[model samples]
Target chain A: DAGVTQSPTHLIKTRGQHVTLRCSPISGHKSVSWYQQVLGQGPQFIFQYYEKEERGRGNFPDRFSARQFPNYSSELNVNALLLGDSALYLCASSADSFSYNSPLHFGNGTRLTVT
Target chain B: QQQVKQSPQSLIVQKGGISIINCAYENTAFDYFPWYQQFPGKGPALLIAIRPDVSEKKEGRFTISFNKSAKQFSLHIMDSQPGDSATYFCAAEDDKIIFGKGTRLHILP
Candidate 1:
């Protein structure tokens, strides 16, 4: 089976601009989460969506937002991007929302470079 | 405060030797612990995982040792190889996952 897939493998944006990253979860998966990994750092959660509803959010600012489609695909939108926003955006998906043992499968990630 | 703290930003080990990485978490509620391995230009993939209920879990050459009382966990790679060189991240999951800063492991041939 195909793992999680993300679109526009790479992206470039300017300060104050906006960017949208897309993710398609594996078949039969109902939950997707977004994370940003900066150089030399671990991923920081941005948002999570399951069954078309917001399940959880991280400490990111309002500038970061996300939505899940009925098909379980997800999109992350970053508004007024800052240079600091340049990082690898990772998308991970799990089979269910509440399963304690649900292991997340991740996509290769979209590398965002904001100048 | 960082919810999870990982030590020794980087590690180097000779082939066939053992390489260990440590991490400690502050949230006692975190019952699930997992380790992820990532290569250059690729996202992290699950290496191994353990729950507080288990003291240690071994999958092939990788093992996760969990200390529930101390809220600390570690990963040990046995018979290290150049192929094992990558970045390793320790994570704790409660409602969601909190990841450590990550450790870069380089196994020399």
Candidate 2:
């Protein structure tokens, strides 16, 4: 099966503008999570959606929000982009909540650049 | 309290050697521990993971050693090769996944 896929492989936007990122989970998977990986650092959890409901949210600001579709796809929206928002936005999917039997598979990621 | 601290920041080793990376977590609720490998321009891929109930788990040349009591774990790469070079991240998970800063491993051929 194809791995998790993310759209607009790369994006550029001005500070204070808004950006929307999209992700399609692997077939049969019902969970999708978003993370931000700043340069020289590991990924930080942003949000997680399961079965069209908000299952978990990270420490990100209100400007960062996400929603899941009936088909299990997801979109991450960031408002008032800051230069600090420049980083690789990653999307990972799991068959279910992460457990010993089920793990996360990630997409290449959408590189968001805020100038 | 949800941070997973990883070390060595970076490492360089000769081929056929052993590569080790260490991590410590402050969140006792983290029940699952996993290691991820990331190459430039790509997302991280899960390498191996272990539960708190086990002391060790191995797959091929990759091994995860967990010390539950100490809240620490480490990743061991046996017979390391140049292909093994990449940024490796250690993560702890419960309701959400938290990752370490990452360790850049460079294996010399």
lDDT tens digits, residue span B9-96, model 1 = 9999999999999999998988789899999999899888888999999999999999888889999999999999999999998888
lDDT of 1 by residue, A17-61 (tens): 999999999999999999999999999888889998999999999
**What fraction of the native alpha-carbon contacts across the interface, defined at 8 angstroms, is recovered by model 2?**
0.95
lDDT values for all models? 0.93, 0.94
RMSD each, Å: 1.0, 1.0
Query: Which ten contiguous residues of candidate 1 chain B have the minimum total lDDT?
Result: B90-99
TM-score of chain A of 1: 0.97
Chain B TM-score in each of the candidates: 0.98, 0.98
- lDDT, model 2, position A112: 94
* Number of the top lDDT candidate: 2
| DockQ score for model 1 | 0.71
Chain A TM-score per model, please list them: 0.97, 0.97
TM-score per prediction, in order, is: 0.98, 0.98
